[model samples]
Target: MDALSRAGPRARRAAAAPGPGPSPLPWGRFAAWIDCVCVVTFDLELGQAMELVYPHDFRLTEKEKTSICYLSFPDSYSGGLGDTQFSFRLRQSGGPRTSPFQDDGRYNREAPLTLQREAAHYFGYVYFRQVKDSSMRRGYFQKSLVLVSRLPYVNLFQSLLQLIAPEYFDKLEPCLEAVCNEIDQWPPPVPGQTLNLPVMGVVIQVRIPSRVDKPGSSPVKQFNQENLLPAPLVLPSVHELDLFRCFQPVLIHIQMLWELMLLGEPMVVMAPSPTVSSEMVLALTSVLAPLRYCCDFRPYFTIHDSEFKEYTTRTQAPPNIVVGVTNPFFIKTLQHWPHILRVGELRMSGDLPKQVKVKKLAKLKTLDTKPGIYTSYKTFLHKDKSLIKRLLKGIQRKRPSEVQSALLRRHLLELTQSFIIPLEHYIASLMPLQRAITPWKNPPQIRPFCQEDFMKTLEHAGPQLTCVLKGDWLGLYRRFFKSPNFDGWFRQRHREMTHKLEALHLEAICEADIVAWMKDKSEVEIVDLVLKLREKLVRARCQHVPVREETLQRVGLYIDTIIGSLPEDLQAVLHHP
Candidate 1:
């Protein structure tokens, strides 16, 4: 009979039950099983095998080396095998037993037929097995494999599908295939070329449990924001202590100094969240310490804070540049100087008036009227009886202050018309005669009647004859008629005024002179002249009551005219002030 018929009902049921023969073990998992068999063969030869394997109910003796010649049944065998029923045999060899056998109650099985064919092609006579307990409940084996191969240090990696959860792998195959196919279509790497691998580029997401003050308190809320974490953290309910024990040797082998020395390049370790625990940071640092001289060993962390909140508000204003000049020269010449130099205004620095002999006048002081002229005029008008009666009638229904102001304005207008106007007209008549008189050779003498007439008009205006008139019309009359050196003073003042007018006329004509002089003068002289022209223009602009735009444009044209005749280089310098 075949092995199935001899094994009773269970073997018959296993052969008839399945839709497929456990599908095929994934390539990686089958290779891992072969590797386990190879290790067992080596260990049993040295009496270091961790599992007791008795062939025909005989314990392996010291110095009697046995090996895993084959781990799977022949193709002719037709029964579903149990976990402990491996097809290994003992072999007698001449070797001193160094290590004692350790029975760890573990066994191995052959891999599926698909993996056996691949193994045979790559490594001659290789065998694979799945280690499991004696009962083999529900056909669930440990996440470990064994392999027997003649090749040295050759390991086979098991696919995660067979080792962990086959159902999950079956479900995820479509998605995984799509991802893998996309990756396969990418451009191939050049031959003999090493890629510049990124140092650390993994993001691990950890979800912190909410803090509560007491039992049954509401759980802390999680932010409903995106990009909170790259990957979800999975916390399993049941703890399997030996779950990772199978990989412990592999981890130790990778981290060993001898293994690292064999590699031409140093290894780098990247962990998530260096801030989480100090021990993890220290451990990573110590592992890379040996390769510090040959490689840049850096450990990076990717942490996302759950409590962090970000907000964007308004921006701050820019800084201001404040330029101040001490003792400015243009303060003396410029009219309406305060207004011209008003803060935040756009006046140029050169247009500022000079701080010379001309005193800085307040806005009120610079007005045409003398100090307290309006007040004195109002007081004088109030004392006049005729003016008072007329003002009372005119402002019968007005407020007291308004009535007073109206009366004062009326009296001032009457004075200006009757007294000031006649005086100005009489002075205007004398200007022609005065101009005709030569001061030195034909100094004209004033008649006694003309002098008496002027005095009579001044005396007739009673209280109106105050300091404003005294400093203005009255002052001029006194200076011309009363002073002993009247002619000398008048002539001197007149000469100064004429000289100023003449200077202005000369300055205007100099533009033409500059054009003429440019032909004969050197570049230095021409440059000096241009500079002087600019200074005069600036000064003229400053002297005006409120510097006129037309005056500035005229001066600017004069400058342009002079500069246009100069050489290109010199013209550029003189083009602007």
Candidate 2:
């Protein structure tokens, strides 16, 4: 049966468009947080199908519908009957990818290019369940409740699904409507602040750490939370996204993984289930903390994905993107990928979780090889035996998993910082002297960053000189320079430096006597000067440049006063807005 026809009347009514009359409460305001709620189920004939999507008008393309269905039901059922939850990310099919600062020529279009570029993707949190029954076809019933959103609140969204999905499977229509209404009341996801989001009577407390803050540090505040069940003081981590838990199994080979991630190498993670597969892929992207991972990645990839043909073709080299897959079929299909990490299922039989063994393979095997990290890539940094010994000792003592995760996370964070600190020092040195900058001509261009020159600095000042962990630092830097992450980092710094120069020039102009400068000039020249100053003001407001608001305000007053003194026709042209 077609999905809509199979849905009950209540389901249809809840999702239907508003009838022609008084307009319904605006949903577009909340669209930034939650896009739509959807119900997907397995079809006897059509395979995975989208049965219902709330706000029926929030449409999905055919390709999107198929992808969502496949991702929502990540694993094919054999005879199981249990509920599983996970999250995945996909390219946003519909939405404005424009900058949040976009307005009617008020903000500079080129200021927030990174934010606009990154807005092209969105996230999905899924709660899937299955039950066995002789009365149903195939002896089972299976379905999934999914929340499609742009924010990456893994802990918050998964908790929301846990509260709603079970009730949804039991009561159906009422549960869907209730959840949709609750979501409609949620506030916009403003970063850098703690937000108490209520869904289906549960207040989920979380904070999406701001990029402006220091990595790994987000302040916590007590809230008078009320719910059917007591909520956590704060989610264990709304910032880290449970990255440490995902990397726990493969903790031993983390340095090797970090190297590969930094170099933006094409790797495939093969896991026993979609939950593990997706988490592993997402965690890999954040290994180079504080520096963004610019390469593309798919948390859960299947043979049915739209890019399957492009990702699997042997005719060309694999794209520089991380691909996570659950099917053994990918073992043979993606065998040509440079790096492959095969993760084993969770082993809960022991008091303490045993670290999975890692083995490097000479040839890629379709089914015979065991679970381990399989790659020929050599690691430049030496393994930290001291840290490994402590971890192993903690395992021997049967330390709690939470303690183990924290220990690992701290070590990785320090390792990344050690690598980044030296670069920051060198980049700071490249900045030109403030005295050399003049108000007359454009500020002199900053010196170009050099790889060899940077390498030469290692003898006197490098990560190894300060950090306890040692490595062939030169070798690592060489590989890093060739990666997409390096390109992104360099470009961001270049933009910052360029903006700094512009800001200095602006400050100089603001301090000068603008009225005296334009005293002898014609009306046309005065109008041109005002326009240039206004453009600079807009750019300063839009970009994260070092410029005081007082300077900008003074420049604005100068423009207004200068325009007031002009002839009537010219003044009207200046004040057209």
Candidate that would win on lDDT: 2
RMSD in angstroms, candidate 1?
Answer: 46.4
lDDT of each: 0.29, 0.74
Q: What does the lDDT read for residue 436 in candidate 2? A: 78
Give one digit per residue, the lDDT tens place, for model 1 in 1-577. 8887797443453454322232132222212222222223212233224242211122233332222222221212222332211111122244332111111211111211111122111121222233334555534232212223212111111122122223322343343333222222222111111111110121212122111112112223233226434332221100011111111112212122211211212221211111111112222222321111111111111111111011011132111111111112212222222212111111222422111111123432342312110110111111244543454344344435434443443333343334334444444344334344431122333322266566666655532544232223454344335422233333433443443443343334443454555677787876776676566566554433233456557656766877787788878766653
Quality of model 2 by C-alpha lDDT: 0.74
Scanning candidate 1 in windows of ten residues, the lowest lDDT window is: 371-380
**Per-residue CA lDDT of candidate 2, range 227-319, in tens?**
425574356555355655687677677788888888899999988788888888878977777667788888888888888999999999898
Q: Model 2: residues >4 Å from true position, as ranges?
A: 1-25, 94-118, 225-233, 239-244, 347-361, 519-527, 542-548, 564-577
